[model samples]
Target chain A: MNRSALVSQAEPRDFIALLKPRVMSLVVFTALTGIVIAPGGVHPVLAAISLLCIAVGAGASGALNMWYDADIDALMGRTATRPIPAGRVTPGEALAFGLVLSVLSVLVLGLVANWLAAGLLAFTIFFYAVIYTMWLKRWTPQNIVIGGAAGAFPPMIGWAAVTGSVSLESLVLFLIIFIWTPPHFWALALIKSEDYARAGVPMLPVACGEAETRRQILLYTLVLAPVGMAPWFLGFAGLTYGVVAAAGGLGMIWLAIEIYRRREGAAARKASGRMFAFSILYLFALFAVLLVEQGILARIL
Target chain B: MAEQPTEAGIVLTPEEKRRQRQRNIAIALALAGLCVIFWIVTMVKGAAILQRPM
Candidate 1:
């Protein structure tokens, strides 16, 4: 009688990893900001349930992504040891797991929260699993640019889940995420060009060359900084989010400039890596300020 | 790195064939569970869309 005898096949770790648990932290946090900040109140239970649905929907997308990209995962050093690739779970098993979770999430959201959110959640899963993974990923260098819309939809969906409709304020959040995505992604691409090339993944650095990729990064950052401040201008968020977003935008541009000046070697890698790390923090801090601003506003109102 | 030559169009091995049978059964059971969940949810509430009636 070994302790693991009852559940010999269904390892907990594979299941947890399927959810892309690390990315879920940021997704959940930003989504919570969208939910709490949108004008109107959500029942505490409904809010919790909506967030749970969003989490499961995100996890479902990750599992489906792992399933679809199992071939690529086995090729690339970075992803070669994922659950499906490692034989911890078969690709078929991973697909089934993702499909089941996807449907369950939509149904749960529809019943527990609202259909608007359920529909958005359904679309997000489809966009990531099918649009990005199945189509855009292998087809073009514009993959991340367009595929980024899938990730950006969550904040807006979270807003609609609370307010029960889309609004200009929610669209501001969407714009920020959409604009922030390309520069954030290209920074990682600059360092991983060789890996992507070896894996036959046509990333920006490999497809367009380093100098061009760097220039695109700078251009996108230029656009993103102003977009990040949309909340401050619209009065959807407060002065705090505005100021912090401006500082983060400047930090992003500084890092992009450093990457632009440096060679595409260790120096550029370190600069791009710093930008990647700061990008995560930048998005989170901005959203956190939005949540705080909303809390203050609610107290005053 | 050489692109590994694989039997791309084929999805059937002895092991895969056996696994496919079990998978079909599993899928049926899962679909049944989903249908049950769907019914229960609808009984719990009406439509999910909270829209203004015009």
Candidate 2:
């Protein structure tokens, strides 16, 4: 590359892509649910600020992940088009962008919400960037298992923002996502074993073989089925959430069974892919149900 | 003066300049948004904004 081409030619959209907007959306949705479901409410403007800070914090972690994982990301077809890997943005720029946003998000969250929420946000950024991306991802197959806590913290942080403290209900929300992560991610890992191997990522299927990965997915799904319905059973949520959670739990189990049974050729890939897609819908439906119940239905009734 | 040379004596192409201008505008908008947020928070909290929880 010539020295003249070294000057950054990245567009604004490239900066947005660096934030992993899709993942940020999920974090914001789940965090918003936490805020809505909590006992007391926050000022509307303050709530918006809290959500913005949490979204930015999640985005910052994603940038740092992309910066650190650029090498391996380039090797994988799925992640190869990310800003740093695609050569639209340089690693130093991404790192600086991530660090700046991380600090600002934490600081602003503390000002608008509470230090507890801000502290959780900061820990989540550190856990994802330093612990999961830098260390656990390459070092162990259980990377997503532990690293999933980072994703789970958004709802807890949201709850903290509203109530200014953590509670059992918030921890239950955290647990649901934490337990759901293994089956959710391992399903995709099963389908992308070759890609994982190529990138040297040591994902479950690459490390433990497809048979064990499928078994682990089934085990985790079995656990998730019960945990997913806990909000209904524990009395925090109403009948609508119970029905949606029960149905989603059953769907997760059935899909896991299909993935476990079909272990040959395209059949295996299709089954894993179905599980991967359904897991996203299942989790989204659960949170969406909870959000509507607590946010709207509760108000009306 | 289509291509402006920086301190390193490296000149940016027209596309680079356009992108740089876009980035600069984005930064300006973001800073302005931050200021607005802070001001709104102050108004919402009134004198109570300074009394934060430990």
Predicted complexes: DockQ each: 0.05, 0.53
Q: Please state the Cα-based DockQ of model 1 relative to the true two-chain complex.
A: 0.05
lDDT of 2 by residue, A1-301 (tens): 5443468868889989999999999999999999989888789999999999999999999999999999999999889999888888999889999999999999999999989999999999999999999999999999999999999999999999999999999999999999999999999888778888999999988988989999999999999998999999999988999999999999999999999999999998999999999999998999999999887689778
Give the Å shift of residue B6 in candidate 2: 9.6
Candidate 1 ranges with C-alpha deviation above 4 Å? A1-10, B1-54
Quote model 2's iRMS.
2.8
Restricted to chain B, the TM-score per model reads 0.50, 0.81
Instruction: Count clashing residue pairs per candidate.
Output: 1, 0
Residue-by-residue lDDT tens digits, candidate 1, A1-301: 3212211244556777988998778778878888888777866656776787798899999999999988888887778888877776767778988998999888778766677878888999999999999999888998999989888888888888887788898888888888888889888888777778887888898888988889998899989888898888887777778889899999988988887898656888899999888898889888888888885466578
lDDT per residue, candidate 1, B13-48, as tens digits? Answer: 455456556656666875796577556545544564
Scored by CA lDDT, what does every candidate get?
0.80, 0.92
